[model samples]
Structure formats: structure tokens, C-alpha cells
Target: MKIDTLQHTSHRTNLAQNIARVILGGFLVMAGTSHLSWSRAEFLAQVPSWLPIDADLVVILSGVVEIILGLSLLFFTSRRRQVGWVVAAFFVLIFPGNISQYMNGIDAFGLDTDRARAIRLVFQPVLVLLALWSTGAWQAWRKQQSGD
Candidate 1:
């Protein structure tokens, strides 16, 4: 009876975590799409001048990648490992843009305050968590630990 109670609790927790992941993944996907549309110029302008690629192309390409990551998070279980890798890669790739924004003091969507900029820098890790949660990697790790 106690074992059954623990199992039920675990199942409920997993379901809740999965729901949170879906919501977070959906928000990220939508946010990325909105960035592609409403803020393309502003985001492009944030691109560091030193970066060789034209800002316009960079914005479009980044938008495409975000969309891909977002969709992968939402679906595609067969490629779960691949998706996890891609999300991690995407997080790494876009971090420079975050840095560029801080260094250049670039403003987008009217986020110009220093406090806001600091918050921006601090937000990257949350993206990885969201990605991992969406991929169920966090749950897998927890389960593996429990088995051991």
C-alpha cells in the first residue's frame, strides 16, 4: 500500500512537470516567433558590429532556429536526444547575442534599463532548464538516480 502511494505521487509529479514543460515550451516558441516578426529589426540591430554576417540574415536564421527548437520541444519523441542536443547548442549559440546586448547597451522592445539588462543576462540558464524539462531529460535523470 505504501509502495502504491509512492508510485501514485511520482506519477502525479511527473504529470505536473510535463504540463509545466509544455507551457514553457509553448511560450518559448511563441516568443521566438514574435521576435521574428515584431522585433526583427530591433533584434538585428542588437547584433554586434564585429559579427561578419549581415544583421538581416542573422535575424532570420536565428528566428528559424528558434522555431525549430520550439517545435522540437513540443513534439518529436523519437529524436528526443537529438532535440536535447540541439536545444543546448541553441542556448550556446544565442548567448553571444545576449552578451552583445549588454556590451553595446542595445535596447529592444523598450527594455533599456540596466536592471532589465542584468535580468536578461541572468535568464539564459532558465532557457536550458525549460529545454531540458521539455525534453523530459530532467525526469529521466531523476528516475535513473532513483533506480541506483
Candidate 2:
């Protein structure tokens, strides 16, 4: 009975994780689409002013990259661990943009106030955690660290 319970719990966990992964992928794709389309200006507001590249070009390229990452997350089950790591890194990499938005008081995505922007920044880490946990990347990393 205990073994059966364990198996059931494991299955439920996997199902939840897969659902979360799909949701995150869909969200990324939608955001990416927005970056290239109606919300281009809004995305530009998030780009750090100190970045040397043209903001529009950066937004466009990041949009393309986001689409690719989202597709990989949704379809590349065999490489999910790697994808998760990359996704987490991508989140980390883009964090400076969020900080820039807050520090510069650039309003975008309904985050008009400094407090709102600061709150938005808090979610980036959650995204990183989501990317890692939903794909079991965190567990894999732990196992590797312990040399299991």
C-alpha cells in the first residue's frame, strides 16, 4: 500500500510539472510574440539604457530567442534538463533589464511606479525556480553535485 501511494504521488508530481512546463512555454511564446508586435515599445522600456545595441533590434532578437526557448520547453522532452538550465540562465541574464527599468523609473507593462517595478523584479527569480523545478533540473543538478 505504501509503495502504491508513493507511485501515485510520483505520477501526480510529474503531471503537475509537465502542466507547469507547458504553461510556462505558452507564456513565453505569447510574450515573445508581443515583443515583435504590439508590445514592442513596452519591451523597449525594459531594455537597459546602457546597452550599446539598438533597443529595437535587441527586442526583436530576444523575441526570436524566447520563441525558440518556449518551443524547446514544450517539445523537447529528452533535453528538458538542459533546456531548463538554459531557461533559468536566460532569466538570470535578463534580470539587469528589470533592474534598469526600476532604477531608471521607466514605465512599462503597467509597472508605472518604482514600487511596482520593484515588485515585478521579484518575479524573475520565481521564473528561474519554475524553469528549474518544472523540468526536474534542480533535482538533476543535486544528483550530479552529490555524484550519485
Candidate 3:
């Protein structure tokens, strides 16, 4: 009975994770599309001005990357764990943009106030957690830690 219950719970968890993964992938694709087209300038507001690279190019490249990562999350089941790690790392890498947005007080994406921009910074870690959890990466890490 315990084993059966465990199996049932595991199945439900997978189902939930799969749903989250799909939703997150869709979001990434949409955001990536925006970066390439209508929302390009808005994204520029997040770029750190002190960076030497052109903001436009950075936005374009990161947009392309977002699209690719989104697709991977959707289709790369065999490598979902690695993709999760990559996606989480990507979120970490872009955290500076969120920080820059808050520090510079550049209004974009309707983040018009310091409080709003500061609030937005909190979501980056959530994205990282979502990527890891939705991909079962967190489970795998736990297993590794337990030497199972």
C-alpha cells in the first residue's frame, strides 16, 4: 500500500511538473518574440548602460537564446535535466539586467517606480526554481545528495 501510494504521488508530481514546463516554455517563446520585435526598446531599458556591447545586439541574441531554451524545455525530454540547469543558469546570468533596471530607475514594461522595479527583481529566483522543479532537476539533485 505504501509503495502504491508513493507511485501515485510520483505520477501526480510528474504531471504537474510537465504542465509547469509547458507553461514556462510558452512564456519564454512569447518573451523572446517580443525581444525580437515590438518590445525591443523596452528590453533595452533593462540593459546595463555600462556594458560595452550594443544593447540592441544583446537583446537580439538573448531573444534568440530564449527561443532556443524554450524549445529545448518543450522537446528535449531525454536531456531535460541539463536543459533545466542551463535555463536556471540563464536566469542567473540575466539577473544583472533586473538589478540594472532597479538601480538606474529607467521606466519600461510599466515598471515605473523604484518599488516596482525592486519587486521585479524577486521573480528571477522564482524562474530559476521553476525551471529546476519543472524539469525534475531538483529531485535529481536531492537523489544525488542522498547518494541514492
Worst 10 residues of 1 by lDDT: 4-13
Please provide, for model 3 over 1-148, each residue's C-alpha lDDT reduced to its tens digit, 9 standing for 90 to 100. Answer: 2332211223223788999999998889889999999999999888898889999999999999999999998998777777888999999999999999999898999999999998999988999999999987777766655655
In the range 5-121, model 1's lDDT, one tens digit per residue, is 222223222566567656765765876786679877787867788899888888888777777777776676545544665786788788888888887788875769767877988
Where model 1 places Cα greater than 4 Å from the true spot, the runs are 1-13, 138-148
Task: Compare candidates 1 and 2 on lDDT and give the better one.
Answer: 2
Candidate 2 accuracy as TM-score: 0.89
Number of clashing residue pairs in every model? 0, 0, 0
TM-score of 1: 0.76
**How well is each residue in 1-148 modelled by candidate 2, as lDDT tens digits?**
2332211222212888999999999998998999999999999998998899999999999999899999999998777877888999999999999999999999899999989999999999999999998887877776655655
Which stretches in model 3 have alpha-carbon errors above 4 Å? Answer: 1-13
Clashing pairs in 3: none
lDDT (CA) per prediction: 0.69, 0.86, 0.86
Give RMSD (Å) of candidate 2 vs. truth: 6.3
